[model samples]
Target: MLRARPKGRPKATDVELVDVVVGAPDAGHVRVENLVMSVEPYMRGRMGGEATYAEPYPIGEPMLAPTVGRVTASADDTVPVGALVLHERGWREHALVPASECRIVAHDDLPPVVHLGLLGIPGMTAWIGAERIARIETGDVVFVSSAAGAVGSTVVQIAKLRGATVIASAGSREKAALARDLGADIAFDYHDGRVTDLLRDALAQVGASGLDVYFDNVGGDHLEAAIRVINDHARIALCGMISIYNAETPLPGPSNLIKLIWRRARMEGFLLRDHLDARGEFEAQMATWIRMGAIRPVHTEFAGGVAGAWDAFLGMLDGTATGKAVVPLGTLGAGTHGGNDSLDKEANR
Candidate 1:
């Protein structure tokens, strides 16, 4: 649990590991042994003890996040023992949760971790932004910021699959290369020079006059730059602002707000919780894409179970992890499930 609201950039001392008792579930609940949990950038906001899209994590209480596990004991017959389930009580080894909060993962062939990454909130956010909000079309020139991260990587692939030319930006050369490998037409490191200059050069290289769609994961400089070169009636989807997630004080807005009026462009911010109606469709389409090798899920896994989740979260915010950062707690045998074996091999190298 968080010691208190962070004063500035959060530190390891803000959270501590304490022993707790796990009691058996009541009539409509089950006891889950968590197998894997997701660590994402948005979680940083929750720790600030301020209201946002989601409720703030109370001080001195266990943090919650999307988790995948198996039901070890169940009081509800509908959710049988040993059934794989997805819930939102992570940062712990065992969670006693209502059966209604558990979503059974029907696909037995895929790795349990998949439920916390590509097929989870991150992937769904990308899908909704690209397909519904941005409405990316063939021939459209799209710009995706933080293009090597979890949501941005998925947005890059979805734009390419829709026949849009993609311009990707990342923090480092290695991550930039990753964006290109994932099918971006041009990928650049944001640390190279001014973001505006880099974006202009990328657009010129692709022979695009201006951006048709912008998927923003990193705000601040990236948002300002995208606004500077937007085409007439362009669309921008505000997925996240990882660049300022750890700021101590309020940051300045983009200086180009007037450009939206001049360009007749539309920019909208979204939350995945509001779009739950589309989850079934998104999951089905993504599953097909995965099986056909049209889309790949990218993530970095930490091995020390629940205790490692904090480090994984910190690493993600510090830009140390390439894609999604995940913590696996249980032993799910290899080759029995569908995970990215090629990425594992590359990590070993």
Candidate 2:
């Protein structure tokens, strides 16, 4: 099942558990005991044998991702024992990583996964895309696609925090309701009918003069709709394109791109890593907002055994999972109770 490059059906087939030797930190490396690593849509693109925004996962090498782990050993003085660090430890159980490559996650009132979700890369993407790029302002109208997912949920909250009237689109009625609970001014089901018609109704009801900001998470039709509804000088933040990630062939471009010229709308694409220098300021501000109940990180926890992890990932891509899709990597016999592990107990202190 292992492949040097992806062939047919991009999946997590190259899974293995090899005994990894932890060498002494070589000046810049740190040894970590990983707890949880996220399986996101971007990982699927890396396995598809295509040039992407990020590096492709190499064959016969450990798959890399942001993992929340404890620093068991350190080669750098800046990172010490028991320090909860976020690093690209890949699929393995542990890793030796460069000190500068990881962030020192101080265990505060937040859980380890928050370092991956809220305070993590996804959180930054949602925040910066909405706050800085979208420039969400009070009384502005904002629309977010994939509004029930991780980054989408964050975008909904961030837009609300800035006083923007928010509208969100989800794949199901259930997700739409959840999006409403997360402070979205309006939530529509993308599966109901023509998303364009639903968007028009939402704008008419809200009395919006086009949209001030469009936080696009899904591309293709969603992008086309946002372009048509954007007001002059509206800002569009291109976050991700989950719709086209798995297409066997390249999909068509937006047919309504001409609207950009007419509306004078600005559409810009950016990876979260580009704004690393400003992350500290953003994180600190978000932490204070979180403490004040101004923001929330909505997540869905899948409890199936390790064997069901792949199914969970696919479920997320298919738009079947609500909120932030997460499969908890817990021991099978860890607890007798059956339910989502308390988010309050594990995440928020």
Candidate 3:
């Protein structure tokens, strides 16, 4: 990201993929050639030159993300060469990350892309929001906006696992069906009409008074809708607001917020980094869920390596991706033996 896209939506033309030579690792660092890099909606905030929970992305420097790569060279004993590792130095072909910061991957039965998808940051975000923040209780009525997306998809599944009836909304009918396949009790097309009416209709069909937890990814109208009909003491797990992330001027706050005041409902925003203490538990539960066929991750892979990264980022932010979008960089996963064609077909199956 060379310059901030302050005026309008960020475009591929705004970023420059300038190459730089890589040197040997320092005493405690390991050089990792990224096999895959993630393109998520949160990156939009970092590149917008605003000070939020995350720092503004530095111009004229390599952008960063959670990257999975093989240790080509290492000066640390714990992370030796040839080991598959995960770190946060993406946006370039290779990164020299601190040994302590990298985690050794031991996955075999599952594809490595899971490190960037269901078991990755998005997965963690989903779990933390549903379990920790929203506390989605059993039999609770939960609504997740952007339910076909990486985080929202996971939230839909997790909410089901916790025995909640999930009402999911997506931009299209296909995505809504995807959410239905993921076990949502009701899935609707948010773009076709007013989401608040659709939600009210869905709840009327279910005979529920109001939603217990509104796990929001697409904010705007969705937030307003949830605010319109929340149960007493309901929770709004404020996650990504992708609908408003690229907006130049501030959108209006929900008019029905007085309902929150009247119902004594709570809306709390969270960052995944703020809840690292629960990651180990989350990983264990996610692994078991994957093993027992409790969850299936949806993923969209970009084969254009680093060059197509910008378009992939824009595509995901623009909500074109069928699932969690990522750029498959260097060699596929360590044990995974396949070309780009096979890799693309293998994901989300």
In model 2, what is the error at residue 36, expressed in angstroms? 1.8
The candidate scoring highest on TM-score is 1
What is the overall TM-score of model 2 with all chains considered together? 0.87
Q: What 10-residue stretch in candidate 1 is worst by lDDT?
A: 335-344
List lDDT for all candidates, in order. Answer: 0.87, 0.76, 0.84
Per residue, candidate 1 scores C-alpha lDDT tens digits across 189-278 of 999999999999999999999999999998999999999999999999999998888887889999999999999999999999889999
lDDT of 2 by residue, 35-63 (tens): 66666778787765667777777767766
Q: Per-residue CA lDDT of candidate 3, range 1-349, in tens?
A: 4554544688666787654556678999998878898998878788777788889788877778888888889999999999888888887667789999999874635777888888899999999999999999899999999999999999999999999989999988999999999999899998778988999998988789899999999788999999999999999999988888888889998888889889999999999989999878988899889989999978888767777777788888778886688887856532222233332232332
Error of 3 at 336 (Å): 17
lDDT of 2: 0.76
lDDT of 3 at 196: 86
